[model samples]
Target: MAIVLFALPLAVVVQRLYHDETVTGLERDATRIAAVVPDDLIQRPRPLKRPAGLPSRLTVGVYRVDGRRVTGQGPGRSALAVRGRDGRVHDGAEHGRLAVAAPVPSDEGVAAIVRVSAPYDPTGDRIQRALLAMAGLALAAVACASLLARYLARRLARPLERLTAAAQRLGAGNFSVRAPRSGVREADEAGIALEATARRLGTILERERAFSADVSHQLRTPLTGLLLGLESALERPGADLSAAIGTALDRGHRLQVIIDELLDLARDTEPARRHLDVPAELEEITLRWHGPLAAQGRRLVLDIQHPLPAVSTSPAALSQIMDVLLGNALQHGRGEVTVQAADVGGGIAIDVGDQGPGIAEDAPDIFARRSAHPSAPRGTGRDAGQAGTRTAAAAGHGIGLALARSLAEAEGGRLILRSSGPTVFTLFLPDTSMAS
Candidate 1:
């Protein structure tokens, strides 16, 4: 486009210059012929016509000293005057005549004006031909430029297109699409970066998968023994022992719940995503938990916005996140718990707010293994002196918030602590695509 823009005007100017030079040359030859004519011819005006050595197309006219026409011949009766000064041609146009006037030297005090005229039609024709030639050249230049632009666009776009495809594949959990290297240095650099990212991601995913499997394997034996022991205790033969056994069984059950949560978290690295209506899902969860909330003397409020878009997420993962949020509320809250859902641009968003003792300022540290917050209730004597042991045993359970965040991220979403007051904790889940 840049080249065409300059070339077009340049061609037009060149064409005009060539035509002007041609017309000036023709006028100069006519002036020279008029100069050689004898002085006697100027005083007595007659048809002293020259032979055919000059161009037959040329037209000539002679005028007396008083500007009266002497001889006129050609397409038009009127002729243009040619003025000569230092052997240079000067042109003038008047009275339907395009003129080049020159002075003819004479012994008589009166000098003669030699004028030449050609019909404007021939000059117009030459200009039209010149324009036509320029148009053709412009057309040819445009064709070549178009081809070049297309070739350049293709060369630049091909690598970017491959990168797009590779990104889509990565999004689909296929991390094996390597971009083909081609084109310039910048393109090669981008390809190399993509390949490196894929390799690192593949390695990280493989490690996570292996770690999950190993954790499941290592915990199987202890989990089984704990379950069996609780069952045997429940079947004990004495009333007092049975009561003790029941208390032990309750503790064992809590441990079992913790282990189950861990297994779910480990397996939740990859989640099945599906579109779910936000209002409907929230209603169902609220219904299921209504009895429990009422039993605890807490009011559950639904402040859902209708017509929310369906969110792409894993149902199980979403449920687990909600469970952790609600469970934390129930365990710690003293008043109302509110659940709300709404549309936030590209996807649906859900927030669960509880009138509980809100997250401690140091809550983030709880995500680390064995890091205990001062706010957590201390265990009784039976579990005392067991802080280190219990910390190790319950290591996986305290990561509920962390698990919620991880599960949300796996489904291309985020779990955030929106706001925390003295007695409020709000958990907000927003789809990643919506934020983007």
Candidate 2:
């Protein structure tokens, strides 16, 4: 296809140039022979010798005005000669063969005419051979070009095929799949972008899965406690109706609190600018988890460096973040968990530290959604959904921490892993309450 597009025009141009050169040489030879005639030929007729460099097939004829071949064998016609005119070569025919003619000048005015002729058979055979050779060369060039085009087309097509497959998988909910980069520049660029989109989609999906699973993590503990309380009440002989109802109501209230916090986490709305009492929020959150920590034989300590001032942050967001931190401490930490507060900038810094064998140094990407504890089993909350151990073991830190940090930053705050020796994570919220 490429050969047809480019080679045909090239062949035409080459042939035209060659044909023009051949004709120009022929006309020039005729004029040269006419100019070199000796003066003695006018008085007495003599056969002209073939001019040097003239084709052997070309025959010359000298004629009087009336049209007669004086020496060579050719058609004798008066119109074949361009007499007493400028050096413009005109077409002359000699017995059905192509030729060129020019007038022979002398001391006498318009003395004689000389016509040069070449046999049509030989001239045409030479031209046909040249055309055949040119055609063959053109075909070879076209074949080579076709091969090159096919190679380039295949090179480009394979990457696009991979990209198409990747797109199909993406549409099929396989966001983890990626396309490999082909060496072709444009295809490589597209492949890079395709893989990039795949990574983004995979992140979004993993977060969604974690979000749904998070409900199980946060609510399962309270739900389990509520169930156990009802089960205990049922087991009692002649249980007091008012007492059971009160116990159930209390457990239900705790579950509602968990649900409301989870709902706030899922809202995806911007935080309202307001002053938050960090110490008060810290004390309340610690109190909520006090029972769970005491059950696990671990100590929960609060270290206040100063009279912590109020900062600009949402209480609901802070509560949810504390849940993740304290819940992690309860489930995974050893010894004691200390939550410290301090004054920093226009806000306060709250550090949640767990005295456990902190995260391993080689544990990859701290924020990417992946397993935190490789040995710990993963489940969908079928077993171990009790109040003491929620879904914390199954819900990895990657999902929890990533969400916590994103939420913190979205509300114009910062979350950082201060130290891994004790696995300390610090939270800082700026004072946005004064902003317009």
Candidate 2 regions exceeding 4 Å error are 1-29, 32-55, 82-89, 92-94, 164-178, 185-203, 216-315, 322-340, 344-347, 351-436
lDDT (10s digit) by residue, model 2, range 322-355 = 7777777777678788999887767778899888
lDDT scores in order: 0.59, 0.69
> How far does residue 216 in candidate 1 sit from its true spot (Å)?
6.3
Candidate 2's displacement at residue 413, Å, is 8.9
Candidate 2 TM-score, true structure as reference: 0.56
